[model samples]
Target chain A: MAVKAVKRIDLSLAPLVENTRRVIKGLKLHTICDSGNCPNMHECYGSSTATFMIMGNVCTRDCRFCSVKNGKPQEPDKTEPGRVAEAVVKLNLKHVVITSVTRDDQDDKGVFNFVETIREIRKRSPGTVIEVLVPDFGGIEELIETLVRARPDIIGHNLETIARLYYLLKPDSSYFRSLSVLHMVKEFNPDICTKSGIMVGLGENEDDVIEVMRDIKEIKCDIFTIGQYLRPTGEQFEVKRHVDEDEFQRYEVVAGSMKYAYVIAGTFVRSSYRAGEYYQKYQESRKG
Target chain B: MKEIILPELGEDIKEATVSFWHHKEGDEVKAEEDIVEFYTDKANFSVKAQASGILKAISVKEGEKASVGQVIGEIEER
Candidate 1:
């Protein structure tokens, strides 16, 4: 294994960053950047960009690699959609990403919040690009179709890890089911850009990684992201090994050649990291 | 002399941190040449030189932050 790469997190609190925190707090909203303890929080908030975690902070599934709290979550807030839309307007965001904690307890599996959030954003900020990073929703066709009908500019559901390690990292989720989620999106609406992401350094080999990439690409997923899996806390899954920078570049090159609309693979790349920029590139590719 | 101002990055992005300077002061540069790189929270952008000239000064050193439209550097035109 290569020597671990030392990464730094900037702790500076710029004005915009402060304002972003203030807005989220003032609205009593949750952001994955804060809930997940994302390394890029400072920089992202500094630019007035954030991935809003709708529904609630608590998740229904206990994915070992995730840092989100897993347990019985409160009832979904009916007013969340409007507040999220209000945040988009207050921040003057041109692009917005809305994600949620998996809500298996809900009757519709939390698709209602996603649909309503999309509706609210469209009504309030018509020009802002919306991307949603969602869970598999138990791979229910009707639930997936409901979200598809909402017509977000991009929809993402992370594969998280290779098929072989699926039971280990995300025991509650199925690898084939996740792929089906992306496939179903394209089936319902080919025009909506579909995306998926995975984390490395989870004890998967290069071949395993490539196999997963091929699987995602085979589904005609428009965008793919790969990032190093940093252990958010000692309680989460341990980092099996740190993937080298060169290896990450190799993955990007390999995925790029596979004809993905956009491929971002690196140590710090997250599902919604640079999502707006990737959406723009995907749009440009459609034009070309 | 020509000033190199940080152009509008995108909607809602009002500032960025200087990541690198491609050339040192006194180095000749061509118009539209990528002279410096800036990184916002989400993405990286390369700012090009406005005119062919010698990179005379860098007002914002690396790792420092600058808002949109701020003059980050200057060039002495040929």
Candidate 2:
């Protein structure tokens, strides 16, 4: 394995603002930021923005790197949709991101909740642009169609790692299945911006990353995010390598050249990081 | 006394080097106040105190690497 030289960049941390606190407390909703301990929480919340984790925090799958607890998931909260709507109205955010923990235990894999959440948010906050980061739903075509019908501004499904590390890292998820999800999203609505992301330093080679990028492009995914993977817990997988700043820049160039509409690559880049900024950029690009 | 375990930074980070500590044992800390700085593959992050208390012990030293889920220090509740 070639040792990549690491460069440490100083990140400007943002403070949590009052609007962020009100939304969390008012809705009584849990976020991946609080549950997973996202480093960008300060910056995001400080900006009065947040990615809401709907359905519930407990995931059905036991991914090694995810911090969300796993087990039998609780039943979806029927009132969560209304609460989320209320929070959006109160926060007065220009952009909204709603994600969920994978709930395979349910028949629809929590598709109904996703649909209702979008509906409610649109109803309550008509001007706020909405984005959703959803799970594969075990390749259920109906579930994908359901989310498509809801008409979110952006529909994202993370291809968490390269195919070579898929089994080792995401034993329950299928690399091909995830690709299919992204492809189907665009197939259902070509206008809807489709997005996916992958983590680096999981022992995947440059070729592996390139292959995944090609696969994503083949599916016509519009947006791509590549970030360094930090093991969520000690009991989880060990880090195979630390990708440097230069490598991230190289990946960004590769992704852009592949014709992805927008690409964000770096250590702190998450699926929802600077999501509002990107969503605006996509809209502007489409206008031209 | 409650031990403050090293937190998981993201999905793939398993171990992190202790970059610095904001307070020594016996220093009073406010609830949610940041106590230590650690470097992971992603970035250098501060571990905050979950409860208001006194720094009781430092199990991990600066520049040392700690695995996620391992206790790095202990805090005595105020």
Best of the candidates, DockQ: 2
- Minimum summed lDDT over a 10-residue window in model 2 chain B is located at B5-14
Candidate closest to the true structure, highest lDDT: 1
The lowest-lDDT stretch of 10 consecutive residues in candidate 1 chain A is A5-14
DockQ of 2: 0.11
Error of 1 at A152 (Å): 0.7
- Share of real interface contacts recovered by each model? 0.00, 0.13
Please estimate how well model 1 matches the true structure, expressed as its whole-model Cα lDDT: 0.85
Q: Label model 1 with its docking quality class.
A: incorrect
TM-score, chain B, predicted structure 2: 0.88
- Against the native complex, each candidate's DockQ, computed on alpha carbons, is 0.04, 0.11
Model 2: runs farther than 4 Å from truth?
Answer: A1-19, A285-288, B1-43, B46-78
Q: Please, what are the lDDT tens digits per residue for candidate 1 over residues A1-288?
A: 664543333322345667898899899999988777676776688789999999888899999988789999999999999999999999999999999999999989999999999999999999999999999999999999999999998999999899888888888999999999999999999999898988998899888988888898789998888998877666888888878889998987887687853678888789998788877877787678
